[model samples]
Each structure stands twice: as structure tokens, then as C-alpha cells.
Target: MPGSAPLTTKDGRFGYEAAGDPASQPLLFLHGIGGAARAWRGQLDFFRDRYRTIAWDMPGYGGSAPLPDVSIAALAGALQDFLQAVGATNPVIVGHSIGGMIVQQWLAKNPRTAGAVVLAQTSPAFGKPDGDWQKSFIDARLGPLDRGETLVTLAPSLVNELVGDDPDASGMDLARDCMAAVPGATYRATMLALMGFDLRSALKAIAVPTLVLSGSKDNNAPAPMMAKMASYIPSATYVELEGVGHLANLERPLAFNAALDQFLKANVTATQVTA
Candidate 1:
């Protein structure tokens, strides 16, 4: 999806890659902490002819500017700014991992901002900021960087651990490349950002069609967690991919895209939904 140089927002605070007709319905993809916009090549290509498909690099990744304060709310504001700059309206957003968290936060404020959303491989809460699970999670991600190893060196192992039982060879390679490109500092910031996330209460307030897609093998955001999350959202539909892991979109892109496309057609494009 990325061109020779990434496309920047009017304020130059965000960078994104886009395809398809700009005047068409907006279909934006937000990558996880380990990924940049280029990681969404499959999604961009698949939806390019049908919608204005755009994939964005989170602030501080790729050509996007870094945020002074990194919180779920701040990231949500950045998302709004980026979409506005690109003239995207009534968008159908697909968010993975932390990207999903940002969508939840954005909807918390602007309940009707999106026409529909897919929250894939994500959770509503991370326990507590200073809890053992939170600490261990952050430590695990940042430990290698602290030991003087770069993401380039650790990407192979990290990606290996995140994939499912069935994975595409090319997708695995792209996942590694995206993880390797992530700056260590931004990764650390985002990991810490997860500690403060507790959007369980906000789930019920979302006023748009939502898909809570999960992987049975995703220990990070387990299937049960996603199912419970779906139960909380009034308009949510839950779907779990068997034998899949945390990186469902990358590992099982075909299935992931199928589920997402089906949800969009049923709730958004093929039907008229109020946003």
C-alpha cells in the first residue's frame, strides 16, 4: 500500500498509504504495534477497487510524527485528525491489536464517527497498569531491546511466536519485515500505553456496527475475551478463527478478509446504516 514516500496528513502528524477511488466509501486499516502501513498490502489490494482503501502508520512509526503524550485517548484524537485530513467520512475501519484499542477510544468520544468497525485480535482491558500481567507483558516486549538487541534481530523470533497453526509463507515474511521496521522507542511507548487501557465500560456505548474477530490460539487477546467483548457491544458480531493466533490478519489473511468483508457487506455497504 505504501508508495515511494508515505502520504502525510495536512498537519504532517500522520502518514498513510491509500488506493482505489478517493470519492468512494472509506475503508481504513490500522496496524498493530509491530506493523506499519505497508504491512496492510493485502487489505489495500483487496479493497482498492471497491472502496477508498487506506492503511495508516501509527504516529511515531514510518513517516508519521511521534506523539508527545501517548495514551489511548491521544491516539484516538490523532486518528480523527488523520481521517479528517484525508477527507474520509462514514469510514469502515479495521483495527488490529492496539489499533483496535484506538477505535474503542475514538468511539467513546464520537460514538457515531464510524459507519462500522472490525476489532480484531484485541482486548478491552489489560488488567491494571501496575499489575503483574501488565508488567510482564511490557517487560517481555521491551526486554530484548534493553539487552542491546534491535527489533531487526528479534523480529524473526517474535513473529514466529505470534503466528497460527496455518500461515502463508509470504505473509510471515511481511509480518517480520513490518516488525523489524518498528522503532524500539515507539514500541515501548505503545506497550506502556496498553497498561492504561480499560475500555470495558465504553463497549456498550458504541453506536455502530462492530465485528469482534479473534483467534482461538491468540493468548494475547484470547477467543473467550473477544466473545465476552462482543456480548458487551449491542451491535457486535463475534467470530473466532480456529487454530489462529494473535496476528490473525497476517497469518490467516484469507479467512480474516472473508469474515471482515462479510460483516461489512451485511452491516455497511450493502445496507444503509446511520453513522
Candidate 2:
């Protein structure tokens, strides 16, 4: 298995960490608001032997350039450009949290761009932006920064809330490091960008083979929400990983990788045969 290393596009607009064989089928991993490219290290290493695995630090995270504005459409556009730059055609996309939202937005615009999609521990909507719940959600996260605390100071508690009841120490450390490294401005922008996101209606139009993976203990994107999300897409398969939390890939890498491998083999093989 190959290790992840920094990679830049020819245009220098995007930066990512890539592993695996360039000649193999591409598998792209997108991380959540609290994550960076390194969040998918386990997946990249696990799948590198069989696929060209790449994990991107979304625009504004890691060394990637920040977008002028943060919104689902804009993020999706950035993803489109990144795909083109990397020469990936109809690759498999494995997205977590907001990363899953980006994949959904991208699929809404380019239904045929992916060979398959894995929506892991994410929701189809953020609920009403003006609703009390939304306000509370945003306030709770932003209030810390408002009080003059940096991400480094808030990372421990934030990550604690996001992980499972019993999480690996190493996974917790990685999550903390990723969250702590995020710039305050970018984190705030991303939080606000998700305010009015709603793609429930567009799920049925996703024509590619899809897998919805959920963590049984994920409070943020609960199993029920993921099940409903899976139901919206035609013939989508839903798998719940017991004892895992929002960071399913990190919390239970072996199980996560196994589920993904099974899905890719079945769906990618079928798609190739039909083509």
C-alpha cells in the first residue's frame, strides 16, 4: 500500500494527497467540515493497492485555495474543476458529512460523472436556516470562536462530541489534529455555507450506483436519517456500522473499507459490463 503525499494540479489551484496506482480506477475521498485530506488516511492506505485513491483538502483547507464564497454550488463547481484537473473520469466518490453534501450537489449537476458514490454519515438537508434548531446548532459551534477561543482550544471537546462512545485513541487524536488545524475563518464560512442546504428532492435523480454508510452511534447524522437518505435514491444500499460514530472511516476502518470494497466490486463490475 502506498502512503499519501502532497500533490498539486498543473494549474496550482488545488492541492490533495494521493496514493495508489495511477493506472488503476480512481477513488476520491472527501472529508467533512472538521476534517482535512489526512482524515482519509486509513481509506487511502487500505484501497491503494486496488485503486488510485486520492483525498482532497477541500478549497480553503490544507494548501488548497479558498473560494471567494462558500456554498454547495460553489463547492461542487470546485470539485468539478478538481476532477478535470486530476484527469478522473467517472471515478468513485466516497464522501463524509459536508463532503457528502458536495458530492450530492455535484451529482445534481453532473449525474453521470461518477461510477459510484458512497454517502457516509451525512444528511440530505440541514433543515431550515431560520429555524430555532439551526440557529442553536450554528451558535453552539460558533459561540466558542466568538469567545476568543481558537480551533486548537475547542478541538478536543468538539471531537469528543462527534466520536462514538468508545473510540480509538489514535482516531481521536487524528480528528483533533485535523479540527485544530482548520483556519477559524474557513470553519466559520463552511458552517454558514450549509445554512440552507436541502437536496432531498434531488436524491431520486442520482442515477449512479450508491451506497449509504452510517454509524450506529452518530448523533450528528443519525442512522435513521441516513436510512431515509438511502431510500430516496433508487436502489441505493444502506449499511450501518455498529459501535461507530460520525467518523466511520476512522473509527472502524476495516469495516468501512470492507463495505466500500464490496460495493465497488459489485457496482463497478456491473457498470463496466453494461458499458
Candidate 3:
């Protein structure tokens, strides 16, 4: 019931694409950088029939509006406003990649989350990257989306890189479409925001049943780095998806769904009791 409607918050407007049973529990989904809410289509189709699932497009990405000011904390505050607007007292928040970092920071201020999951990624503070990593926000990969290049011409190359070696041409194509649909200014601002933000300490402050899943082959957020994240979060459960890339949910939907199902089942009962 909560999944299908539009929820307007103090910060901006929020919406979710849902399907599952109306009577089931609620689950909020967050996507990665340059990703739209539809990125969770696999999970939406699988769990919406059993659980009330709602996925969001991050500010400045997908259908969501641009942020007043782009920063992890600002996004976190917007998330809080969204939850309150939607009247989600304690919905389980599930996020991927950069989304995971925002979720962690959001939970630091609002500890009322039923549970949270970090899928196929970790925070920006994982392994010590090169000194220029944080400073370099604009690059050739996102030149079109960040600058003035046309999406029709830029979609192919950028989409191929986003999909990596997923072996799912269809999924890759869909992601490419979403990326192409994104506005250049929105894409650029969001990437700039992600560059300097760090949530290392926020991991420990999160006081919810959390699941952290990493892809072994994820060059973006590798296993060793996520493993360290799992170690930091006192209540986090770590699981690595083998032979998968950054887009684990899309790359290996079966494995991704299985892991998600297990985490939900394990926490569903406890969450009900607490609620």
C-alpha cells in the first residue's frame, strides 16, 4: 500500500514503483550512482508479490529532482524527510553502492530503521585509494552525461562500461537507457557530491540489523574493501557474490535475490516483534 503512491517531503518529492501484496511488510530500495529507481526491477518483480517494496531514485538521478545542495549529509536529510513524509515509521532501507553510503549516514541520525542492507558495494572509505581519486570527479567515462554530449550518441560506450562483464546485454541496454535519460547537470552534480563524502564512522553508529554484500569481481567496490566495512559495522552481516561486478543485482539476479530473500526472512520475524 505504501509503495504505490507519491510522498512529498520537506526537501522534495519522492515516489516508488511497487507490485507485491498490499498486506505485506514494507521495504525501501535505494540505487547506486547514475542509477534510477527502476534499477531494482528484478527485486520489485520478485518480492512485490510477497512484500510491499518501494524503490527511490536518488536526488539528481533518475526521476528524482536535483538536490538543493549536493552532499551525502544533505541527501541523508532528504531521505529522512522522505521517510517522514511517507509515514514510514521503521521501514527497512536497502541501498546499493553510493546509495549504501547515504543510507549509513541517514541511519546515523535516525536509528528507527527496522533493518538495512548494503548490496554489492561499500562506502567511499573502503581501501585507501589514490590521492587524486577524491579530487577527480569529472572524467572521460561520464563526459557526455557531465558535459553537453548528446545521449543518443553517448549511450553505447557509457552503458557498456556500466554493465562491465555482466553478460546481460538486455539489462545493460536498459541501464544505458536510464543513464542516457539522466540530465547532464544532474549527473555531474551527483558525481561531484560522491567524490568527497566519507561515511567510515557512520557505519559504527548504525544501530540496525544490517546486511553488507560485496561482489568479488567488483572493481568499483571490491571484496577486501567491503570485508573491512563488514568488520567496522558491529551489526553488519557480510556476504560476497562471486563472479559478479558492480551491478550484482542486475548481473546475477538469481544470486542477488537469493541473498536478499535470506536476509529478509532472517530479519522479518524479529522486525515484526520489535515493531
Candidate 4:
């Protein structure tokens, strides 16, 4: 509720929503492919009292400009710029789905930039681009857009598939609205960019405290896969939220926030005290 207002970076190239004390430790949220900054509204409100909570619209989503070349590295570079623009130092970064991929990419390049990280409903690898499974996965998502169906028309059903069976009505509406608002070109490019993603080798290099969260019912990033990913990270803790789906934050905000709080208290707060 606090970060309901839209905001832009000092240069106006990136758009986001912000709440809480600017001087406090920052909590930066990155949404999934189907989400924009508004997708983290619950998080911004929940964490506002203690942290400078901010949710960003990734490049080409919402009010942000499109990246000239969409890739994990490019998105990570954009994230670095966004962090500098916002004046966040060693922030707690939370990312979902493809957003999590971007987080991994950033950490690979700037290993010491974050105090902690939350990777929810995401994978360390997208699989080989030429693999049968990967090819089918890309085609299934792109086929709809290639057929001239706009995201506005396809969003309802697309979002429905990513949520749990007993999803909150308001959450469903929010997910649909955010997905519908994505530019078709951006969505297409993002899907293609994912084809080349492979961060399996970078997992062990994550030196900061990390939380790998998965929805038990998530089909996109299965619980077992996320668990394996956590095993590879030296300082990682894995959490599985039962009855939730790919849209963990939206599907079950309380559970999602609780896991995040636990990580913050154990890792972030203690780090602050030691510093």
C-alpha cells in the first residue's frame, strides 16, 4: 500500500515503485516474466517499515525502455545501473522466475554487491537451446504471440495456468492485469533471451546469503529443481511453500513474506550487527 505511487529513476529511463525510509537498508524486488513492479505491491507494503522497499519494471516492461539486446548479461547491467541510480548499497535483492536469472547473472559479475538474495520459482539453467524440451517450451509460449494474439487477450488464461487452484481472486486479477500490460515485443524478446540462459555453473559462486524459494505446486520451476539449486549455493536456504504456484508472491503473499522475513532476520540483520 505504501509504494502505490509510480516513480522513475533520476534519469527517467527506469520506472519503479518505492516505499519506506530511503536511508534504511534497501529491499529490491524483481518480478517474473508475467509481472511488473506492481506485482510486488504486497512486498513493498509488508517490508516498508524496516527496509527501503522498491519494485522495478524490468526494461521493456511498464514505463521502462527496451534493451537494445535482451540477454541475462544485459539485464544484469541494467540492474546495476538501476541500483546505482537508486543509491542502494548491498541491498537485499528478491527476484522471481526470469528475474531470478537476472539476479544470478548480476551476482556472477559483481559477487559482493548484495547483502542477501531471494530466488523464487526459478531455475539455474534453461536447458540447451536446441534440446527438444527447450524448443517445445519456447514454441509453446511464442506460438500464441506469433499467431497475432496480443498479451491483453491471452493474459487471463496464461496467468491462470501459473497460479494455484485456490488462488486469491484479487491476486488473480492483479496477475492478469500485469501480464496483459506487457508489450508483445518485449515478451517475445524475453522469451527468446531465456533460450540462451544457463547459470548452472554459477550457483556455487554465490557467496552472499541466499534464499531459494519454490512453490510446491509450481510447474515452471519445480520444487525439486529449486532444491537442487540451493544445494549448489554455499550459503543458501531452500523453502517450499505448499499449495502455491509459480506466482508465489502473489499467490500467497503471507507465506512468501514470512520466508523472506526469516532470511532477513537470520542473514541481513546479523550482518548489519557484525558490520
Model 3 clashing-pair count: 2
Task: Give a tens-digit lDDT track for model 4, residues 131-237.
Answer: 99999998999899889899999999999889875887788889999999999989998888888689899898999999999998999999999999999999999
Greater-TM-score candidate between 3 and 4: 4
Output the lDDT of residue 137, model 4.
91
Prediction 1 TM-score vs. true: 0.95
Please list the C-alpha lDDT of all candidates, in the order they appear: 0.87, 0.89, 0.69, 0.89
Candidate 4 TM-score versus the reference = 0.96
Clash pairs, candidate 3, are 20-48, 20-49
Give per-residue lDDT, candidate 1, residue 92. 90
lDDT of 2: 0.89
The lDDT of model 3 is: 0.69
Q: Rank the models by TM-score, top first.
A: 4, 2, 1, 3
lDDT of 1 by residue, 1-275 (tens): 43322588777778888887777888999999999998888888877767788899999999899999898888999999888888888899999999999999888888997889999999888778789878888898899899999999999999988877978888999999999999889988888888868989888888899999999999888899899999999999999999999988788889988998888878987322222
Clashes of each: 0, 0, 2, 0
Where is model 2 more than 4 Å wrong at Cα?
A: 270-275
Once fitted onto the true fold, the runs of candidate 1 whose alpha carbons sit more than 4 angstroms away are 1-5, 270-275
User: Please, what are the lDDT tens digits per residue for candidate 2 over residues 55-154?
Assistant: 9989999989999999988999999999889877668999899999999999999998788999999999998989899999999999999999999999
Pairs that collide, model 1: none
